[model samples]
Target: MTADPSSGAAHDALAGSLKRTEIQRAPLSVAGREIVQVRTEIPPGVESGWHIHPGEEVGYIVAGTVEMRIAGRPTLLLQAGDGFLIPPRVPHNARDLGPGVGEMLSTYLVEVGQPLAAFTEPPDSASR
Candidate 1:
Protein backbone atom coordinates (compact mmCIF):
# COMPACT_ATOMS: atom_id res chain seq x y z
CA MET A 1 0.00 0.00 0.00
CA THR A 2 1.05 3.53 -0.67
CA ALA A 3 1.97 5.44 2.44
CA ASP A 4 0.67 8.93 2.98
CA PRO A 5 3.33 11.60 3.33
CA SER A 6 1.86 12.66 6.66
CA SER A 7 1.87 9.16 8.11
CA GLY A 8 5.37 9.44 9.49
CA ALA A 9 4.70 12.77 11.08
CA ALA A 10 1.51 11.51 12.58
CA HIS A 11 3.21 8.47 14.07
CA ASP A 12 5.91 10.68 15.51
CA ALA A 13 3.27 12.82 17.15
CA LEU A 14 1.59 9.73 18.53
CA ALA A 15 4.86 8.47 19.98
CA GLY A 16 5.51 11.84 21.53
CA SER A 17 2.09 11.82 23.07
CA LEU A 18 2.67 8.35 24.45
CA LYS A 19 5.92 9.48 25.97
CA ARG A 20 4.09 12.23 27.81
CA THR A 21 0.74 10.61 28.54
CA GLU A 22 -0.33 10.82 32.18
CA ILE A 23 -3.27 10.26 34.54
CA GLN A 24 -4.20 11.70 37.91
CA ARG A 25 -1.26 11.18 40.24
CA ALA A 26 -1.52 11.26 44.01
CA PRO A 27 -0.10 9.84 47.21
CA LEU A 28 -1.25 6.73 49.05
CA SER A 29 -5.00 6.19 49.13
CA VAL A 30 -5.67 9.55 47.52
CA ALA A 31 -9.00 10.36 45.96
CA GLY A 32 -10.04 11.25 42.41
CA ARG A 33 -7.80 8.80 40.62
CA GLU A 34 -7.72 9.00 36.84
CA ILE A 35 -7.05 6.43 34.12
CA VAL A 36 -5.18 7.15 30.92
CA GLN A 37 -6.04 5.58 27.59
CA VAL A 38 -3.95 5.82 24.42
CA ARG A 39 -4.47 4.24 21.02
CA THR A 40 -2.00 4.61 18.18
CA GLU A 41 -1.27 2.84 14.93
CA ILE A 42 2.21 1.50 14.45
CA PRO A 43 4.04 0.97 11.20
CA PRO A 44 6.61 -1.69 10.51
CA GLY A 45 10.04 -1.53 12.20
CA VAL A 46 8.90 0.58 15.10
CA GLU A 47 9.27 -0.26 18.75
CA SER A 48 9.13 1.01 22.32
CA GLY A 49 12.24 0.66 24.43
CA TRP A 50 12.64 -0.97 27.81
CA HIS A 51 10.63 0.92 30.38
CA ILE A 52 8.49 0.58 33.46
CA HIS A 53 5.10 1.81 34.57
CA PRO A 54 4.02 3.09 37.94
CA GLY A 55 0.50 1.73 37.59
CA GLU A 56 -0.69 -1.51 36.10
CA GLU A 57 -0.96 -1.80 32.30
CA VAL A 58 -3.61 -4.03 30.87
CA GLY A 59 -3.71 -4.31 27.10
CA TYR A 60 -4.96 -6.44 24.25
CA ILE A 61 -3.56 -7.12 20.82
CA VAL A 62 -6.57 -6.16 18.81
CA ALA A 63 -4.94 -6.43 15.38
CA GLY A 64 -1.67 -7.68 13.96
CA THR A 65 1.27 -9.14 15.81
CA VAL A 66 2.90 -7.58 18.84
CA GLU A 67 6.07 -8.95 20.38
CA MET A 68 6.60 -8.05 23.98
CA ARG A 69 9.37 -8.68 26.48
CA ILE A 70 8.73 -8.58 30.18
CA ALA A 71 11.77 -7.60 32.16
CA GLY A 72 14.64 -9.86 31.09
CA ARG A 73 12.54 -12.65 29.67
CA PRO A 74 12.45 -13.63 26.04
CA THR A 75 10.11 -11.74 23.78
CA LEU A 76 6.62 -13.16 23.75
CA LEU A 77 4.49 -13.01 20.64
CA LEU A 78 0.89 -11.94 20.95
CA GLN A 79 -1.89 -11.99 18.39
CA ALA A 80 -5.34 -10.56 18.03
CA GLY A 81 -7.60 -11.26 21.01
CA ASP A 82 -4.60 -11.94 23.21
CA GLY A 83 -4.17 -9.86 26.33
CA PHE A 84 -1.49 -9.34 28.96
CA LEU A 85 -0.83 -7.36 32.08
CA ILE A 86 2.25 -5.59 33.31
CA PRO A 87 2.47 -4.87 36.99
CA PRO A 88 3.83 -1.66 38.44
CA ARG A 89 7.54 -1.04 37.97
CA VAL A 90 8.04 -4.11 35.82
CA PRO A 91 10.21 -3.23 32.87
CA HIS A 92 8.94 -4.14 29.43
CA ASN A 93 9.44 -3.37 25.74
CA ALA A 94 7.31 -4.06 22.68
CA ARG A 95 7.33 -3.84 18.91
CA ASP A 96 5.59 -4.94 15.75
CA LEU A 97 6.57 -8.42 14.65
CA GLY A 98 6.47 -7.88 10.91
CA PRO A 99 6.82 -5.30 8.20
CA GLY A 100 3.17 -4.44 8.29
CA VAL A 101 0.79 -2.20 10.16
CA GLY A 102 -0.59 -3.20 13.54
CA GLU A 103 -2.50 -1.68 16.45
CA MET A 104 -2.85 -2.18 20.19
CA LEU A 105 -4.96 -0.59 22.89
CA SER A 106 -3.70 0.09 26.37
CA THR A 107 -5.42 1.14 29.59
CA TYR A 108 -3.49 2.06 32.66
CA LEU A 109 -5.04 1.76 36.11
CA VAL A 110 -4.23 5.04 37.68
CA GLU A 111 -6.80 4.99 40.40
CA VAL A 112 -6.21 5.52 44.08
CA GLY A 113 -2.69 6.77 44.55
CA GLN A 114 -1.25 5.85 41.15
CA PRO A 115 1.80 7.70 39.97
CA LEU A 116 1.24 9.17 36.55
CA ALA A 117 4.82 10.21 36.00
CA ALA A 118 5.89 6.60 35.99
CA PHE A 119 4.79 6.39 32.37
CA THR A 120 7.66 7.79 30.40
CA GLU A 121 9.88 7.41 27.37
CA PRO A 122 12.06 4.34 27.42
CA PRO A 123 15.80 4.61 27.73
CA ASP A 124 17.79 4.80 24.49
CA SER A 125 20.00 1.81 25.16
CA ALA A 126 17.40 -0.95 24.90
CA SER A 127 17.00 -2.75 21.58
CA ARG A 128 14.88 -5.41 19.89
Candidate 2:
Protein backbone atom coordinates (compact mmCIF):
# COMPACT_ATOMS: atom_id res chain seq x y z
CA MET A 1 0.00 0.00 0.00
CA THR A 2 1.10 3.51 -0.70
CA ALA A 3 1.75 5.92 2.16
CA ASP A 4 -0.76 8.69 2.72
CA PRO A 5 1.12 11.85 3.55
CA SER A 6 -1.95 13.56 5.04
CA SER A 7 -2.86 10.86 7.51
CA GLY A 8 -0.19 9.10 9.52
CA ALA A 9 1.92 9.35 12.64
CA ALA A 10 4.60 10.95 10.50
CA HIS A 11 2.26 13.78 9.64
CA ASP A 12 1.48 14.25 13.31
CA ALA A 13 5.17 14.63 14.05
CA LEU A 14 5.60 17.01 11.15
CA ALA A 15 3.08 19.34 12.81
CA GLY A 16 5.95 20.55 14.96
CA SER A 17 7.23 22.59 11.97
CA LEU A 18 9.17 19.85 10.19
CA LYS A 19 8.60 19.73 6.47
CA ARG A 20 8.08 16.23 5.07
CA THR A 21 7.83 15.52 1.42
CA GLU A 22 6.94 12.07 0.21
CA ILE A 23 9.38 10.90 -2.42
CA GLN A 24 8.16 7.41 -3.27
CA ARG A 25 6.23 4.38 -2.06
CA ALA A 26 6.24 0.96 -3.57
CA PRO A 27 5.56 -2.61 -2.60
CA LEU A 28 8.57 -4.67 -1.75
CA SER A 29 9.22 -8.22 -2.87
CA VAL A 30 8.59 -9.31 0.68
CA ALA A 31 4.98 -10.13 1.24
CA GLY A 32 2.97 -7.75 3.37
CA ARG A 33 5.66 -5.11 3.16
CA GLU A 34 6.29 -1.88 1.35
CA ILE A 35 8.98 0.75 1.16
CA VAL A 36 8.34 4.43 1.63
CA GLN A 37 10.83 7.17 0.95
CA VAL A 38 10.55 10.69 2.33
CA ARG A 39 12.58 13.85 2.32
CA THR A 40 12.43 15.70 5.64
CA GLU A 41 13.52 19.27 6.28
CA ILE A 42 14.14 20.12 9.89
CA PRO A 43 14.52 23.70 10.99
CA PRO A 44 17.50 24.45 13.14
CA GLY A 45 17.09 23.49 16.79
CA VAL A 46 13.91 21.55 16.18
CA GLU A 47 13.49 18.01 17.40
CA SER A 48 11.50 15.19 15.98
CA GLY A 49 9.87 13.95 19.12
CA TRP A 50 10.59 10.40 20.24
CA HIS A 51 8.89 8.05 17.84
CA ILE A 52 8.97 4.55 16.36
CA HIS A 53 8.25 3.05 13.02
CA PRO A 54 6.39 -0.16 12.33
CA GLY A 55 9.55 -1.42 10.65
CA GLU A 56 13.14 -0.44 9.99
CA GLU A 57 14.27 2.98 8.78
CA VAL A 58 17.39 3.51 6.70
CA GLY A 59 18.26 7.17 6.42
CA TYR A 60 20.91 9.45 5.03
CA ILE A 61 21.63 13.00 5.98
CA VAL A 62 21.55 15.29 2.99
CA ALA A 63 22.53 18.58 4.59
CA GLY A 64 23.37 20.25 7.87
CA THR A 65 23.76 18.25 11.08
CA VAL A 66 21.63 16.40 13.61
CA GLU A 67 21.88 14.58 16.88
CA MET A 68 20.20 11.20 16.88
CA ARG A 69 19.08 9.80 20.18
CA ILE A 70 17.94 6.20 20.24
CA ALA A 71 16.86 4.35 23.32
CA GLY A 72 19.58 2.15 24.82
CA ARG A 73 22.24 3.52 22.50
CA PRO A 74 24.77 6.28 22.48
CA THR A 75 23.49 9.46 20.88
CA LEU A 76 24.92 10.04 17.42
CA LEU A 77 25.97 13.30 15.90
CA LEU A 78 25.46 13.05 12.14
CA GLN A 79 26.09 15.39 9.26
CA ALA A 80 25.81 15.52 5.53
CA GLY A 81 26.71 12.24 3.78
CA ASP A 82 26.18 10.26 6.96
CA GLY A 83 23.79 7.38 7.14
CA PHE A 84 22.02 5.54 9.93
CA LEU A 85 19.59 2.75 10.55
CA ILE A 86 16.82 2.55 13.09
CA PRO A 87 15.46 -0.78 14.16
CA PRO A 88 11.77 -1.43 14.13
CA ARG A 89 9.79 -0.16 17.06
CA VAL A 90 12.82 1.49 18.64
CA PRO A 91 11.91 4.89 20.00
CA HIS A 92 14.26 7.63 18.91
CA ASN A 93 14.44 11.38 18.42
CA ALA A 94 16.41 13.50 15.97
CA ARG A 95 17.33 17.06 16.74
CA ASP A 96 18.70 19.44 14.16
CA LEU A 97 21.80 21.19 15.42
CA GLY A 98 22.66 23.64 12.77
CA PRO A 99 22.80 27.13 11.40
CA GLY A 100 20.65 26.01 8.49
CA VAL A 101 17.85 23.58 7.88
CA GLY A 102 18.84 19.90 8.11
CA GLU A 103 17.73 17.64 5.32
CA MET A 104 17.42 13.87 5.47
CA LEU A 105 16.20 11.16 3.20
CA SER A 106 14.58 8.23 4.93
CA THR A 107 13.40 5.00 3.45
CA TYR A 108 11.18 2.84 5.58
CA LEU A 109 10.55 -0.84 5.06
CA VAL A 110 7.28 -1.37 6.81
CA GLU A 111 4.29 -3.58 7.01
CA VAL A 112 1.68 -2.64 4.50
CA GLY A 113 -1.06 -0.33 5.78
CA GLN A 114 0.78 0.62 8.96
CA PRO A 115 1.42 4.23 9.86
CA LEU A 116 4.88 5.44 9.00
CA ALA A 117 5.68 6.31 12.60
CA ALA A 118 4.14 6.47 16.06
CA PHE A 119 5.11 8.98 18.71
CA THR A 120 6.24 7.71 22.07
CA GLU A 121 7.26 9.17 25.40
CA PRO A 122 10.95 9.76 25.87
CA PRO A 123 12.82 6.74 27.21
CA ASP A 124 13.84 8.59 30.35
CA SER A 125 10.54 10.27 31.08
CA ALA A 126 9.35 7.79 33.68
CA SER A 127 12.11 8.66 36.11
CA ARG A 128 10.96 12.24 36.45
Backbone clash count for every predicted candidate, in the order shown: 0, 0
- lDDT by residue for model 2 over 1-128, one digit each (tens)? 23355653245444557888777888999999999888888999998888898899999999999999988888899999999999999999888998999999999999988878778988983222
TM-score of each: 0.62, 0.87
lDDT per model vs. reference? 0.58, 0.84
Q: For model 1, name the residue pairs that clash.
A: none
List CA RMSD, all candidates. Answer: 8.0, 3.3
Regions more than 4 Å wrong, model 1? 1-14, 17-32, 72-74, 111-128
TM-score of 2: 0.87
Model 1 error, position 50 (Å): 1.4
* 1-128: candidate 1 lDDT, tens digit per residue: 01134442222223543332222222434455445554545566566655665577888777778888786455679888888898877777777776566577777665554343333454443453
